[model samples]
Target: MKSILITTTALVGFAATAGAQEVNVVSWGGAYEKSQVEAYNKPFTEETGITVNMIAADNPATPLKAQVEANNVTGDVFDIEVSDAIRMCDEGALVEIDPADLPAAPDGTAAADDFIDGALQDCAVANIFWGTVIAYDTTKFEGQAPSTAADFFDLETYPGKRGLPKNPKRTLYLALIADGASPDEIYDLLGSDEGVQRAFDKLDTIKSDVVWWEAGAQPPQLLADGEVTMATGYNGRFFDAMVGEGKPFEIIWDGQYMDMDMFVIPKDAPNPEAAMEYLKFATDTQRLADQAKYIAYGPARQSSASLVGMYQDGKTEMAPHMPTNPDHLETAVMDDPEFWADHDAELSERFNAWLASS
Candidate 1:
């Protein structure tokens, strides 16, 4: 009887081990996402003996919703743009995060505290931050660079072909700012008919010189190929082109628009606990810093700033992407994700119509 009982216990243990599940993660495709999986997820899998299945989705929302509605919300943890994160939370598609269940919150004095206040929130934590800065071909601009949106629109002073995102939020914001509206006044101004018309009118003046970029990667290519002398683009893409390819491109940090990308756990995720553990590990300072070296998106953890020096040699400087750089961060405006989340559909429709008609 004792031998039989021991055999039963051993069989049950083997069964439990065999039943251990894999967590599926959905994230954008980029160097940062690849580094995150390598540094954090792979280690977590090794330590816990749980498998990780990563899926790349250019826009996380479509796949996320399809999985949830199909009752297969197996993509346990995913990263999405801040605007999409907010929209998902509103749609009841994301799970509420319980901080206590996560790895002990980083000690308050640790690098985590350096995250910009209000950047971290209940539904999501900022994973990486990037900016849409003015990227200009150094060969063309030389010493003179466009400093602000007004400069971008000023064809008389800085005449050249320019590229801009086809997305309505950026286009509208830049329009208002170029038309002499403050960043704070953008949403309010767009709320009225006159303000919207004013923005459209301002855009009309520069329409002939503008080339629309449909993808994030296109702007960097446009500048490198000399298709456009100046373009609006994310800092990381421009940094990679300049540093990796030795392209003569430079980013103007003045009046850049800062946007946060966040990590979230989907509702009905099969392995919420494991996913939370992965998030905690991914946000650790050392790993985040290593990621920053390869990918120009700034780390959300404050401690990662100290690690910047490790990447900088006499020949190379990583300062262009560091979030804590006072001169860069001071003038950078945090995009209002909530407004974009609410108005994107209508705004996108109208913007597309205008683009097509123009």
Candidate 2:
């Protein structure tokens, strides 16, 4: 009887402590973070009375992996790309996320059936379907604006510095697109050595005029600063600059690289219960749709699509800007997490060697 009383009291005390602790969510900074804060964080705190701390990183997975390996995990939740989520989960670094634990759609659908294909994973729940699209300074092109992927490589016609992500996964597909590889053939082509060489040769054409950006925020800044006239960047960041800040930029939807951003909790997170609560609350249909108002990222839930409407400014319609729109999907390159999972390391190594040679 004495031991049972002590054990119950200790459990109660631990529960109270966990309730008081904040959930530190690490994610990509800039306008993307701002959108999550506005749509998910603020309301979550209001209802749960738990203070949610948001930390920004160029890629949240970097710090997440470092913290886990060092056994000093600071973040309770991390928003990462699907490829990283899969890689980390396979390494036993993330907590398994069971779909049964998630809230179902408002219309009485199960979460397993409600989420879009590939949005839910073994250890992560995807929140957004985002795109890596090209954005150009409208002022720079006074005539015959760049409308297609092929135009990105037509330096003779466009005649300006191109801003590309330093990473190979993002750049290689665009190179293939500009070189006339069909969207359906991207992954199969990338799997071959000859295809990789073809991509490298295509990249070599504009190697002199390329300005490489590592962070999601840099592409918009590079274009805004006049450092690069045409740049590839997140569609939402470009949306924020064009609509929110009124920057003179226009997005080229052709051959956009569509990818999803997922939310995962580390196995050894500082506050596991609260972290789970935040994950559940923030990924429901309503919250997913709410995110669309702040950024152009498409909601991962099919039910959320009907709920998405005007942008946060209250005047601008958001349908046309979403990368998941049928019109936009026609030429877009959908993400294949398995391909990147198998080839990310080798391609990255070759990409670095090629970069050095240039």
Top candidate on lDDT is 2
- Tens-place lDDT digits, model 2, residues 1-358: 3433443354355446666667899999899998999999987776666788999999998999899999999999999999999999999999999998887788768789999999999999999999999999999987789998889999999989999999999999999999999999999989999999999999999999999999999999999999988999999999999999999999999999999999999998988888987898789888899999999999999999999999989999999999999999988999999899999999999999999994
Please state every model's RMSD to the true fold in angstroms.
6.9, 5.6
TM-score of each: 0.83, 0.95
**Alpha-carbon local distance difference test for all models:** 0.72, 0.91
Encode model 1's per-residue lDDT on 220-296: one tens digit a residue: 88987788988987787787778767898877776678888777888778887667656766665555666766667
> What stretches of model 2 exceed 4 Å from their correct place?
1-18
Candidate 1 runs further than 4 Å off: 1-21, 49-51, 104-115, 312-315
Question: How big is the positional error of residue 203 in model 1, measured in Å on the Cα after superposition?
Answer: 1.7
Worst 10 residues of 2 by lDDT: 2-11
Report backbone clashes per prediction.
1, 0
